[model samples]
Target chain A: MQNETADFEITLRPNTGWMQLDLKEIWSYRDLLFLLVWRDFVAKYKQTVLGPLWFIVQPLMMSVVFTVIFGNVAKLSTDGLPKMLFYLCGQLGWTYFAQNFNSNSATLVNNAGLFSKVYFPRLVVPLSSLISNLFTFCIQAATFLAFFAYYKYFLHTEGLRMDWRAVFLPLLVLQSAALSLGLGLLMSALTAKYRDLVHLSPLLIQLWMYATPVIIPLSEFPEKWRWVVALNPMTSIVESFRLMLLGAGTVEPLYLGLSVIFTLVVLVIGVLLFGKVEKTFVDTV
Target chain B: MSRPAIEVRNISKSYDLGSIGATSLKDELERLWKKVRGREVSARKGQFKALDDISFDVQPGQIVGIIGRNGAGKSTLLKILSHITEPTSGEIVLRGRVSSLLEVGMGFHPDLTGRENIFLNGAILGMKKAEIREKLDEIIAFAEVEKFIDTPVKRYSSGMYVRLAFAVAAHMEPEILILDEVLAVGDARFQEKCLKKIRAVAGGGRTVLMVSHNMSAVRSLCDHACVLHQGRLIQTGDPEECTETYLGIYHPTTESGVVDFKKPENETAWMKRARLYCDGQLGTQLEMGKPLSVEIDFESETEMEPGIGIVINGPEGAKILHASTRNAPSPSFRQPVKGGTIRCDFGEIPFTAGRYTLSFWFGGLSYDTHAEDPCFSFEVIERDLWGCARPYQAAHSILWWPAKFELQG
Candidate 1:
């Protein structure tokens, strides 16, 4: 028995500094992360009428409404791209970011019961949210592709060519995930202590969507005010998506570079804050 | 010497007595403003120490019980050990994989089927996916919910839910397992099975730390125990002595053999005082097989046929003896009268060494007037009733019965 104590597997202390991410611990709990993601995906469609079809139906409806209200009624510009295709691409990108952020922001409060009783990497919650929402984004993206192929190949619509730069779709998606996860981690940490953020989050996300090129093309905004959209960190990713897919939106290299840098910064700050808060959130939450 | 499986070094936890943090931005801004102005901030004024400078060590393969009254820091200490909450000061070193069952079915989603929950719950308890797959059949059979495995747990009866949850947790093989009174769930038969499972886990050279209010469970299951009182480790050693100390702390007695009840403000019947005596001397510690008597002094408003009764309960709250004046073959004070004093004497008591509580009640044929259940507590010390000149093992049985054996061949 004495020889058995040669290795101390874990040491728990009063404070582990703010920057100890413990990514190795998170990797060890990858199974739980997978199960949590599976749970979120499987549980959402349990009793729904259409099941996962709602994933496709949701963005489809949003695009139709945007094309009708913004394109026909409000008469917003879609550059040279078709209104439906323009809105669908924007909706798909924005939905991925919005959904991830929404779920991740509530991670701590919603799972407080489970969190208080178990010992697992708290970051697993937001990471799993990112993965599960990716599945929704995929389904919605497939729907958008069907419309894209119909307009480009089937109808031979004018100026509807897919550029080689469309290969950056995955990178854009990763950026969206990172940005949302970072913001979500920051919000979750804050909301655990000050729940006022809970009520403020939805409004924040809504106002944030208006500032991005979700319903209208960035080309439609005034040149002087375009930099305001560029500052959102999401604008460049959305514009890049439209640029590569529809070949209409602008992709300023400097703005895109700034967006990536800003995302990494938010993500670092978010991770640090989350790591600090997860240790004692059970007490305060 | 090998190192202890767990070394807790002066672990302490504190919390703000008021709100943990300002719930709104307005209040937070106000606090910041005060801090900026160098004014006193009230947030730091109310600090509560849940656990204070507590330390202990657990050896591998040892089953240790942590016993304490409510608000005694038992849960707080377990939370810190399990890493569910961080301690404000001090540290701990654990030599192996540690898993804590702070709650059963903690991560189970109601919408998920029982089968899915087993995997989910198993993963949450730190079992690898492959490990859970290996134990899936055993877990299902143990829970006896094979028929409902595919059904959503929301449809499970609470019994089935708990059974399934415990089954998943039981299969988790960790080097150090922390349990928090989770065995109190389920029926008696299931509880017995869970206890057996835990015992088997410790038998496999693993360490177990459990917090239980059930003293009998602690005594029977734990080889070593620690008694916590108000965030301090008051006692730690043999489970029997630790349990005794825990009971004493919970039910502190003033003096020894006498208990004085507060005088009732306006009552028809009330007990003023009660006393226990052994061998005509007032004492709470009674030797085994020694004669003891209880005396109660009371005053009543009515002159009716009053019946008085005394109940003696063993450490586990099991009734050891119940004597009633109404049941006496030849009743003293047969004539109905206002209460004054009543004494009941008995032959040698056969109770084994343990803490026992005494309760008294006074009533009439038509209606019971007043009763003080568990009015006071006393102890029964071991004595050689058989004249064998050897110490009796009191842990196995609650009673001592004298019997004669002769070699007739």
Candidate 2:
């Protein structure tokens, strides 16, 4: 048996300092993070007929709806890209962001029962949600890639050359995950004491979707309004995603760099607030 | 020797009595907007102190039991020590990995299989995956749920679920273990099994802190005990002595012989007040051979037939005597509106010397209209029983009935 005494010393205080990450303590409990992520991934599809396939089905079905409403009916410009590929590409990023944001925002309230009875890094709750949702996003992204290949090969669609800048796709995904996670943490912290955010966030996320270039390409925007739209942190990521995969949408490096900075700032604020609130969330929650 | 395994210094916890958190988004936003506009936000009301400057220490390789009535800050103290919640002010130092079991099945997901939940619950308690893996078989065997380990826990019976949850908690090999009333669950045999595990764990030189209402269990298991009354540490010493003191304080009878109901029974009828008298004078303590009278004051919103019963329980929780309206010739209510004082008079009290609590019931035959527990507690002191030379004792005795001895030709 390992002597636990040598492992760590614990001291509890009423208030956590303004910035106390306790990164080492969180690092040691990484196994717990893994379990939390696994429970979420498995329990989500346990009794469903489609099981984990719901991951692919959700994005696929939404893509069809977007293709009809935005592509055909509304005649939204896809930057000369095929309708299926264009909408699917946009839906993939939005799905990951929406899912991560929604679940992570609910971390504290949803797990109140577990939180009150045990002690672990409170950050693990939202972090695990981010990781678990990433798995679902990857599965859905695979389906998008399959559709992209079909359009490139059999149809040989025009203006559909894959750009080397596609390598930045990982960076784009990371930015979205970080931004969603940060915002979610902030919301969760506030929601612990004020539950109004729980009912209001889903509607807010829907409204935010139109602000980002999820359905319409950035190229379709008028020159004067472009700057205003670029202010949304997700806009640059979505535009860059399309530019890399379809070689059509604009990719301004400055805008993308600004989004990364925004993400980091939000993340810091979120973590600080979460750490402070988690110390006493059980009592209020 | 080494320092104590745990040290707590002047720990206190207080909660806001207001709407604790925002009930809805609208309320929260309004509060925020009011704050942003620099308006006076007078929503928050009062503060309730749950724990008040509580300090204690537990030495290495010793088991300490915390005994108290409900709402005595036992849970708050454990929550602070376990890091589940923070105290309002104070400090706690733990020497090693501390595992707290405030409840069974802290993270048992009904959708997950028993095997999966074991790992999940273990991790939730800060156990590493490798540690849980090593004790998997032992946990399963201890829970007696091996046959259903692969099945979803939702399919298992509530007992099975508790057993599995308890098994995982019990398997944790922490240097310091804190438990709170989780042993109250499960059957008698399982309870015995859990007690054995707790004893063996303590015997293995681990520091243990336990809070339970089971006085006998504490007496048999703990090396030392602490008694808490209204958030303050009133006593700490031998387990037996601590438990005795806790019971004494918890069942206190008012000096005025009036005990109010802790909670209303229902919309129909409830106990308002209760009092005791010895030989027609208001008093709490009764002489063993003197006349005793109990007065129960009650009220009823709607008129209904109600039966009143007075039950006496001894210090050890055994029923010593019972007097009910049911035994009377006209037990049912004589009128539609039945609300007043019902008195029970005893010519010669038969109880031996001991602390006893009075319980009452006011309801129909099938259901209790209203019931009060520990409504009034009084001490019975021994007195001479009409010139009997035999010595009288209270221990190991319930009642002393009058008997005569004679020599026959």
How many clashes does each candidate structure show, in the order listed? 1, 2
Q: Tens digit of lDDT per residue, candidate 2, span B265-363?
A: 345787778878876788777888788888878777777666788888887666777888777675556565557877878677788887788888877
Docking category for candidate 2? Answer: medium
**Model 1 regions lying over 4 Å from their true place:** A1-8, B33-40, B254-257, B260-314, B317-375, B379-409
Off by over 4 Å in 2: A1-7, B23-43, B253-307, B311-330, B335-355, B361-373, B378-409
Candidates' DockQ values? 0.48, 0.57
Against the reference, the lDDT scores of all candidates come to 0.87, 0.85
Best by TM-score: 2
Worst 10 residues of 2 chain B by lDDT: B329-338
